[model samples]
Target: MATSVLVLGAGFGGMELATVLSDELDEAEVTLIDKGDSFVFGYSKLDVMFGREPAAAVKLPYAEFTKPGVTPLREEVTQIDPEAKRVVTDSGEHEGDHLVVALGADYDFDATPGLAEVDSEFYSVAGAEKMAAAIPEFSQGRAVIGVCGAPFKCPPAPSEAALLLNDDLISRGVRDDCEITFLMPLPSPVPPSPETSEALLAEFADRDIHFVPGARIA
Candidate 1:
């Protein structure tokens, strides 16, 4: 009999896990589940916002993935009983010999006052579309790339946005008229890698982008 693996949340981790398991174990039963039918890769959001890729092309449909021995289930996960190695979703219940949870991080914008009202986000496809429209209108002004909460999904994304914005403004010929600020809760941009943090800081200084360490978005 094959080992049953139930993987929750079809994010990067879950996808890689299921694919690897299916390839490695011919008899293994792998089930990948997520509420969303498709995904826009984290970094791909920037491409859509910056006009590098079309919104339609960037979305990868879950149903199209043809990984052998892996079944994709699109359903909402309502309950998880780890002790029993069971999970309950909107439509059904599942039991497996092993369970893996890779439900990615969600932004808590309410943590920062008035952040929800700004409606300026590049994390989702819709948000990126909005940014695509709004960014071009930014002739000259202060742009703040703030991380609302600590331990964000992609720690380096905020820095990337700040640096990208600087270049974007320069391209628009408003580099001198615009100011870019990055707000991060951590003392270091990439705390684990000091070298990385230093390099990003140097880029910020060279571009004249402001870095606010240990700061709250509020």
Candidate 2:
């Protein structure tokens, strides 16, 4: 009997895993599932937010993804039985020899008080698109990139947003008018690599991008 591998979520990790497995094991059955029919790169959100790329241009349809021995299914996962290597989805239940769960983190806007009403979060695609539309009208103001909590995934995202915002504002001839601040709970921009953190700090200083270390938004 052929080995069956089930992967939950169609994000980068899931898709790569399924593809590699299909290529390595010809007899293996790879099932990749996700709630959404398309995949969007995390950095692509920033591209859309900054008007560099449209929302439609960033989306990669699952229907277009083709790999030998790999089956892509769009279904909401209702339950996961890790021990039994079984998964229950909205469509049906599936049993597999191996189960890989790569569902990304859920962003809860309500976690921070007054955040949903005032500021836009670029972490999500919807938020990015909404901010993209609003950026053109934003002539001048204090643009704050704040991390509400620690241990958040993608540590470089806020820094990238700050840099990109500076570039966008400069292109719009409003760079001098707007003040950009990056607030994070970490002591450094990127703790793992001092060299990277130093380079980022230099760029922030040169661009007049304020870095608030060991700070978190309430």
Candidate 3:
């Protein structure tokens, strides 16, 4: 009998794992499942947030992917039985020889008191698009890029947003009018690498972007 592998949340990790397993092991049955029908790259979200690309242009449909021994299913995962190697989804339940769970982190806006009430959150696609639309109308004010919590995915995203916002304001000829501030709980922008952090600090200083270290946004 062929070995069956079940994978959840067809993100980058899930997709790559399924593809590699299917390609390498011909007799293996790979089932890749996700709640959404398509995949969107993280960088694409930044592009959309910065008004560099539209949302439609960044989505890659899973239906277009063709791989032997690999099956892609769009279903919401309701439960997971890790010991039994079984998964229950909205459509049905499935049992497999191996189960891989790669579902990424979920953002909780209510975790912060006033986060949901804020104008935008660039972490999500919808929020990014909304902020992108609002960016053009923002003529003069303090633009704060902050992380509500620590140990979030993509540590460099906040810094990237600050630099991009600076570029956008400069392009609009309103750079001087807008003050950009980036807040993080880390002692430095990139704590793992001191050289990289120094480079980032230099860039922030040159661009007149305020860097608030060891700070947390409420």
TM-score of each: 0.93, 0.96, 0.97
Candidate 3: clashing pairs of residues:
none
- Cα deviation of 129 in candidate 2 (Å)? 0.2
Candidate 1, which segments miss by more than 4 Å at Cα?
Answer: none
lDDT value, candidate 1, whole model? 0.88
Q: Tens-digit lDDT track for model 1 on 1-218?
A: 99999999998999999989988996979999999989678898888887778888899999998888899999999999999999999999999999999998777777778878999999888898888888889988788888776777778888888887787888889999988889889998988899999999998999999999998676
Best by TM-score: 3
Reference-based lDDT, residue 2, model 1:
91
- lDDT by residue for model 3 over 66-173, one digit each (tens)? 788889999999999999999999999998999999998898889899889885988878888998899999879998888888888788888888899999999999
Best by lDDT: 2
Per-residue lDDT tens digits for candidate 2, residues 36-144, read 9899988999999999899999999999999988899999999999999999999999989999999978877798899999768788889999999988898888988
Ranked by lDDT, the better of candidates 1 and 2 is 2
lDDT on C-alpha atoms for all candidate structures:
0.88, 0.91, 0.90
* Candidate 1 lowest-lDDT run of ten: 145-154
lDDT of 3: 0.90
Report the number of clashing residue pairs per model. 0, 0, 0
Ranked by TM-score from best down, the candidates are: 3, 2, 1
In model 3, where is the ten-residue run with the lowest total lDDT?
117-126
